[model samples]
Target: MTTRVATETFPMPDGSLGARLTMTAGRANSLEPGLLGDLASALDEAEAQDTSAILICGGRNFSSGGDVRAFHRASLDGEAVAYANAVVPRLQAIVGRLIAMPRLVVVAARGAVTGGSAGLLFAADLAVLAPDAFVQPYYAKVGFAPDGGWTALLPERIGAGRTLEWLQSDRRLDASALCDAGLATAVSDTPEMTAARLAAEGEIGTRLATKALVWDEARRARINARLEAETAAFLERIVQPDTALGMSRFIERIGS
Candidate 1:
């Protein structure tokens, strides 16, 4: 409904189908609920009409995570429960949609992905992180446990021990390290060249059809399972001291 959730479908310079999330706010293109729903609809449309794989990219800095300004405003009124009930479910739905998208979903990560954005990258089928790109999941850094299916999806990609380390460390993961940790498919020194090549391969009908049949259903189910599993973990963690401390430290660190 809101034009803020813009979807532009155009042929890539190399002839692939590309989907650009068109709202730019600061270095982080933080998505609102409307934008997330619009993205899901756009993907569904593209899935029905275009057999070409979809490329998800952003305006400037990919995505910097949850709109902390929005979150903070909600928290300011001492209505923490209201904020959690409203925001977290929408975030989870977005994660589910990203995971269930029935095409070869590729992410072109140019800069930083934090919060829910990082979770989306983890669920993507193929992700190419630019050499300078970084990733941070800020849930633990805040006063909450992981949401957006992060608990389930992160462990699958980076393993439980390492996932715990990454979350607990409150550090940023550069593109190369992400690739090495198995979180990303590749790290692209030349993002343009890599994106171009992927576009070429993506435009092929055979690839899309093959992916739709082989990977879509299976991956979606896996992601759904992960979401449920992670939600439980998150609910439990939210009541723990460690999670509260982690969140407090993250909030203070970010503010100062």
Candidate 2:
């Protein structure tokens, strides 16, 4: 498989190390099977270098979530369950690692960010949202349950009742609305530039300490449990006839 993520390092003005992870493969920067390994490799490099901050960005959109086309194809091949089992665990592990990272991590989001990609935004210590950025709770629309720590992270950011309502309604939230709801750190026309600047300028030691304090052992344990449950639910749902129908409708809608 081709590598979807690109990592690079740059020296900060203050002599701190900076790293970037860019998602390069797939039209919508869709998360695929090897993405976790790619991200882990970047994280490993950052950690080894004692990087002060890491910025994650994507081409066009931050991410459109999982590869629905891939899922549909797998469904037809009677391999959807196998695909899910392979990818979902890796996603869980990566999210866990992000939360546990000892340095600052930020997301620079633009265009459509949905499903598992939206869940990834939650793992970031901060997120910079472009003016054109939007978030979609895409699982229900695709007949899959939430994954990538969505169950554990979103409620805390937006409140449980509101999160539940949003998931069921499948509402799309724009950058302004997300920032208003406290889910996004800032809204800017130049989100990537802003995120990169922040990553370079922010107080690294304080940010690392804050991250460590916020995502403690108990929180990590809870997130792990939720991820496991989400994977189980998703595997069950993906193979269902209704899920296939939903996915088909989604594809047709997009095609039309």
Candidate 3:
């Protein structure tokens, strides 16, 4: 229950330890620069620890994605492009690290996990969701290019065609749909506990090796390259004439 780096150690079934990184950004965890920095630090600590797994969960709504309202404001001020440049790289880097981490990475999310934040679920070795939770991509809705592996890594879970279809329209994938699409390991009311329990299973060495084999060096390289492409796309799209209007409309629609 510690908030400092949000690293709470859990004893695993095979007598090893695990680290849980809790997202405590209250009321729809918005991915601000500071929050992203904190998440990067937590991942830093988790990577350095001698643990078998990392469980990422918590926050009222696991995350409402990026601070779109703030992004909208910055757009009006002509700083949206710069803001996207600063934030997209850091967020994508975190996703890269999750994919390359030497141990298991597990995510348990509730409520809204949208935009680039959904990459956490995509990059995880296992992801559990609360039944009522949903995953969405608002890029088309907000006229932003996809970031956070919505293109690069998500296709690895649900395929490219589905990823394209989902992004081009207004739709949210509920937990059951996510599980069916192979984007989630399971759905549960107690997603945090479910994820922690799954993370605690299996031997540490075996789990680590399994993760490495699946997320091998070549695959990691490809993902990183795609993430860079996503970053570039996001920066370009955020500064376009359509983005300000899109953001304003979406912001008013969501009442965020």
- Give the number of the best model, judged by TM-score: 3
Model with the higher lDDT, candidate 1 or 2: 2
| By lDDT: ranked, best first | 3, 2, 1
Per-residue CA lDDT of candidate 3, range 46-116, in tens? 76777778999866588878888888888888898788877889999999999898889999988889888
Clashing residue pairs, backbone N/CA/C < 3 A, model 2: none
For model 3, how many clashes?
0
Model 2, span 1-256: residue lDDT tens? 5677888887776788788889886658777877766877778888999888888888788888788888899999999999888778877777777788787888998899988777778888888999999988787878987887778677766788988888889999999998888878898888888988877775677778888888898988887788788889889899999999989999998882
Question: By lDDT, is 2 or 3 better?
Answer: 3
Better of 2 and 3 by TM-score: 3
Candidate no. 2 TM-score: 0.94
Each model's TM-score, in the order given?
A: 0.76, 0.94, 0.95
Off by over 4 Å in 1: 10-27, 189-193, 202-222, 229-252
Give the clash total for candidate 2. Answer: 0
Off by over 4 Å in 2: none
Instruction: Per model, state how many residue pairs clash.
Output: 2, 0, 0
lDDT values, one for every candidate: 0.65, 0.83, 0.85
